[model samples]
Target chain A: MQPTETFFSGFAPHDLWFLGEAALRTLWLSLLAISIGSMIGVVFGWLLSVSRIGGGFVLSPLLDIFRSVPLIIQLVLFYNFAPIIGLRLDAFDAGLIVLIVYTSANVAYVARGGIEAVSQPMRRAARSLGMTYWQDMRYVVWPIGLRAVFPAWVGVALGVMKDSALVSVLGYVELLKASQILITRTQETILILAIAGAFYFALSYPISLYAAHLEDRWNQ
Target chain B: MDYNFHWRPVFKALPDLLQAALLTLEVAAISMILGVLIGLGLSLIRIHMKGPVMWLASIWVELARNTPALLQLFFFGFGLGAFGIHFSPYLIVLMGLTFNNAGYLAENFRGGFGAVPDTQIRAARSLGMTAFQTYTRIVIPQVLRIVYYPMTNQMVWAVLMSSLGMLVGFRELSGETQFFASRTFRIFEYFAVTAVIYYIIVKIILGASRLLAMRLFRY
Candidate 1:
């Protein structure tokens, strides 16, 4: 933490150990958000595919607003205003709520769009096969829609991973905030930020590659 | 504990918040324009560059798309100062956003270019159009049309991403809200009003883009 300290020379073994823990924390939070959010998205998306006014008119617009607003501002609001709303959430829970809501909005849109894109003629064919609405959805729409939605879900998962850094602003001590802590202690921004960026890239890139793999497989 | 609703603090901070919203718009607008140009250039490089050069372009896209924007902001804001080079918060954020926008838009523009039929380019070339003239007259216009929706999406993204400037202590709309909310202890009201402003700004952009789409794509 000296004035003339080098970012590399100032680095200790435990600075990395701290980063490891933060990476794990970031991973768990993003996984939780994506898993739960995608589940909620499937239900809402299915509903949207079926209903016009409620899904098209209301839910779609609501989700657009959610996507348009920045995640950090939403974090700040939910964290600070929890008390006013009679909600007693710790920082982790508050962060999770924001992550889930944000992820779900994006996923829901993807899911709905995917369902709608599953060709009208195929649905008519399914109907001619004596399939009930539920049976048709279970057999046809869900499979086709899910295939189209997977690539987008990958994007949402990566987006949630990056935006998870914002939860640090709410004092969650996640990866980015932990790096901020390290910067204060070591007085080296370059090394710390670079490591943080690399960690995020490591976390996100594999998921993307996997999505690409699945997309190719499905396309074939 | 029961909470009493207050609108006074929100009303008093209105002018500053509006000004800050404009600043946010300015940052987004400038970065988006710069981003589109850089993105176009980068896409050209991605398509035309060979071997290591193309790999380098792809790396930029991957890095920018994958990492957190906040990290890029911090790197520009604080990391460069480690080398005794300081950037103003505005400049740092602009740099960060430009980097990010170029990366995402490069990929987008590449796809746009792909969507343009090869036959058109060949047809233009056969008619004695120079390379530059072919691009300007035939290819780029179609690429712009193909990518227009993605461009608007990027605009909304830039506007939202500009809020990160607050973390570097740059006072855009969210930053101003953070400032006043803490001072007035009106976190809810300030953010609520600010949220409405963000919502309105996004709505306007969406509305305007819709109108433009209808008019321009009326084929």
Candidate 2:
């Protein structure tokens, strides 16, 4: 494990491929968490919007814990705590669990906001048009509410992707962790970091720009 | 799940953990102050300047905003070390957090500045106020007011983000927790306590911000 003189190698051609694979891991991890967590979050968000006392008293504070504490702590806590609780989970699973809840906590608020953005009169109009409650929700609320919060949800998704770097603490070989490993072996810190940063920027910047564009268009 | 929980070790380390928590707050506070100052300068540069310096500011803002914070910390840690410029872990964390905060705050400041209409600057200029006077007395105050809530949220973000200090070997709250958990092997218990401390810290920051907002914005 000692980084002796010969142990340190220069960056080689294959290193780019290594980084690409690691980037894929980051993508999949965040994608899994966002998709599943969004589903759960939207349901909970709907509940929160409909039931003042139940959601406020019970679910809101429950989810708020994930928001308030640092993701690093939550990752560490869940990773270590899982073994004690007989979960027998590995790093990826533990990281995924924490990421899922963190994503859900965030998406819940956005989903609730999206739900609330559809005015009462609008929902009532849909209902008075002989639509059932579910029909009103599915036909009327979802479209308008989604447009209002799509940008925010994109922000959350990007935030979670960047925050996935913290999952490296659990020894998951995501993009950042892969860079750390390469830095140790190659001793090419700046080069490897630049490459890794480019990978992230390539992934993040265009999405953010597109989100901004959509927001501008919608606002207009 | 037959694991015996050990609260005693965590309780014994409570004072040290609390002290580390204070260090976390201190670093976050210092970074926030530095971030706001640098961010103000950066936003001004973006607004008033062109060419390489403005491009540099944009790159700084975009890179910091787009990249992972831990990667930025590593850039300060080992990336700088590659050039024979070394920093203590504490400085690495401080610099990294400040750099990230500055990037984010700069964007917020730009948005805040954009919210102020062109007419106000014109009015301030027409009053024969110097450029400095116009910005200091007229423009900056309004921008600050517009960005006050965002600044508060950013402060909360700074506190939470400082937990990354542990990765760089800085003995902040999360680092200290990791240290104790390693020693006592009471990982769950120690982190549970640490999480509560963080929650309290966030709540206090939010409460104080609200109270300060009441006083400062009572027009």
Candidate 3:
């Protein structure tokens, strides 16, 4: 079908809704990945921070190299290569796992930084009050560290949201992939792609502003 | 685990992969050069321009920063064709990286500019420096020093992100790797080699940047 001269002519109501559904998938995948990623990251990051002084000194450079490779490369590597190594995963599962690792890597760094940002005196003060180690973390170190890393975490969220789009390479029906299907079907490539970009811009713009606000308040 | 490790396919593919690696670096270097020049202009406009012009520049920066680079590439490669403008994959990917890089570098540059106190610019102006003279002789030199590290990071980032060109059929390093992997049916071996190639590329870039930074910024 030849597209009309105008960019907007071909999108039916359901076509718009199709784009909406794709956006929902993007949000779902991003939210799911970030939630799981954060949980795993806390453990890894806590260990990294705790052991940085003497032990577990080895994991830092490993994580750095792991993350340095492009997300696309990692996604393709994990998705295509895992099954042959006795780790079988379908496209969606593969995408999810790799993205979790991707997001978790960033979160791990943030978590480590957050942990280190907690003051030594504060830890001692909590311990002097007869609080256990867990209590000290729950009360003092956790709150301060979490607060210090809030802005950085938001930045990671934005990064994860964008990175999730790369999972489309594995044939996941996320926003970018869905937009490709629609563009082909309707011959409205420009409109569909613009819509997809707008969806992402919508998600990220407000969060960025909020992150900026948090940074400003923190600086104050 | 029943997998057999085969290094032969990877070794056989080395020459093509290395050549493709060179292509990847070329694209990244060109995009970064373009990004820096355009980013400098964008930063200037964002900071100095007013009204709709400023708003437009800001929206460009924000959208590029926020969207996935993959989608951004598709927008150019496929989306422009709907408007009767078709670009080759190489051009599309280049535009994508350049646009995204410009947005990020613009913000970095803006921050660098903010770090320089107004007193310095005023001092230059009072010393008979024109606006252009003040910027060329004083402001930009200092801002360049402050922003050099971030610029290196962005350069490395461009190299990595250009891997997305594979999706658009641009035969950069990853694209070539994908091609070889599919043909050989040796997915693991092929990607593992590509991963190592990528690692080496990244290390070389980081090392080179550090050495360059040391030479350029001695106290």
Candidate 4:
């Protein structure tokens, strides 16, 4: 690529395409992190519910480290530390690893709360009805507990989506990073930022509205 | 993995990093104070006002909550520069954090206000207290008690969110860590210690909050 001569240019039509692609990267990263993280988190949460001694002593504090630190710091630490440990990971891979751990740490707490929200007597009733342990969980606990925790899970998912913007610090060209590029090149900081902010608002607002709607319906 | 670990530079930089950590807490504390004031006004306006003013508060709350904090910091930095209104990196971070905190806290305040039943306000007014007096003497105390825990959480959030200042070139704890880490190329060693410092700061805030809660809530 040749160095361009111009210091500032007008916003051309193609910047929209760049923003779109970057938004997709943000979405894709968040989706991958939330799905994998939630699965691991659910299992961790189950272990917590089933075995108090092991989970409380060992697993809880381990997860707390991820929650307590800022996501930006965690990204920088992992991105830099990976090479030292012989893992030749790229920016995207390293960020995904960190985000997945971060997501699971958050979701594990929410999932544990959801499981415990289902009263012990309700589970006991299911077991007394000749339901196996797995059967009791799959049938009674899953549906009831999910309703109680779905809104909280949605909050975590949205939070992860917004936080995926931090991956840009690692040089993965996500939406926020793309805006920075456009702003520097075009000298149209406000316009490009407004466009980028709109993309985030568009992506986030509707799901939150839907979550609120679901919460209202469930309460009724 | 033949990377040589270096703790010497990190140990030497501990004092600078600790000072930066104090700056982090300072800005966060200032922002929290400003945010709570703005947030309280916003909640009251949303509940009591009408037309364009209410819309303005609603817009602020929605924009702040729906977007990323880093983006919001960028908005205060480069976005305002478009209008020829440039802010120093410190101002940019302070504005961004205050904006974000007020949005979230407004929602919490609104919820707290709702939890205080209308009947008490009516009762206070029926006793010939003025509207302002009713709120100040009766309503606000209850609202404050209800929202105290959420306020503590928001304070911790302010500290965490202020770390974004590094991106905007504010030399807070994370920025200082990044500065030293880059200079020495001891990225892992520098950041590992920085992470522990962040953990300690968060723990202190949580511990202090617990003690305050006990003192305030005791019957």
Off by over 4 Å in 4: A1-5
Tens digits of per-residue lDDT, candidate 3, B30-101, equal 999999988888899988989998898898899889888888888888878777898888899899999999
Weakest lDDT window of 10 consecutive positions for candidate 4 chain A:
A44-53
Task: List, residue by residue over B160-209, the lDDT tens digit for candidate 1.
Answer: 99999989988899989989988988888898898889989988998999
DockQ of each: 0.76, 0.86, 0.73, 0.85
**How does residue B164 of candidate 1 score in lDDT?**
93
Instruction: Compose the digit string of candidate 1's lDDT tens values, residues A118-168.
Output: 999999999999999888888998899889878988888899989899999
List the candidate 3 regions with Cα displacement exceeding 4 Å: A1-10, A53-56, A121-131
Mind giving the per-residue lDDT tens digits that candidate 3 earns over A38-143? 8888777887888865425677776776677888889888876787777878777898898888778878888988988998988988899999999988888788
Clashes of 3: 0
Model 1 is docked with a DockQ of 0.76
CAPRI quality band, candidate 3: medium
lDDT per residue as tens, model 4, A110-189: 89988999999999999999999999999999999999999989989988999999999999999999989988888988
Q: Give the Cα RMSD of candidate 4.
A: 2.5
Instruction: Give i-RMS (Å) per prediction.
Output: 1.3, 0.8, 1.2, 0.7
True contacts kept of each: 0.78, 0.86, 0.78, 0.76
Candidate 4 lDDT tens digits, B45-116: 999999999999999998888999899999998889889998998899899999999998999999899999
How much TM-score does chain B earn in each model? Answer: 0.96, 0.98, 0.97, 0.98
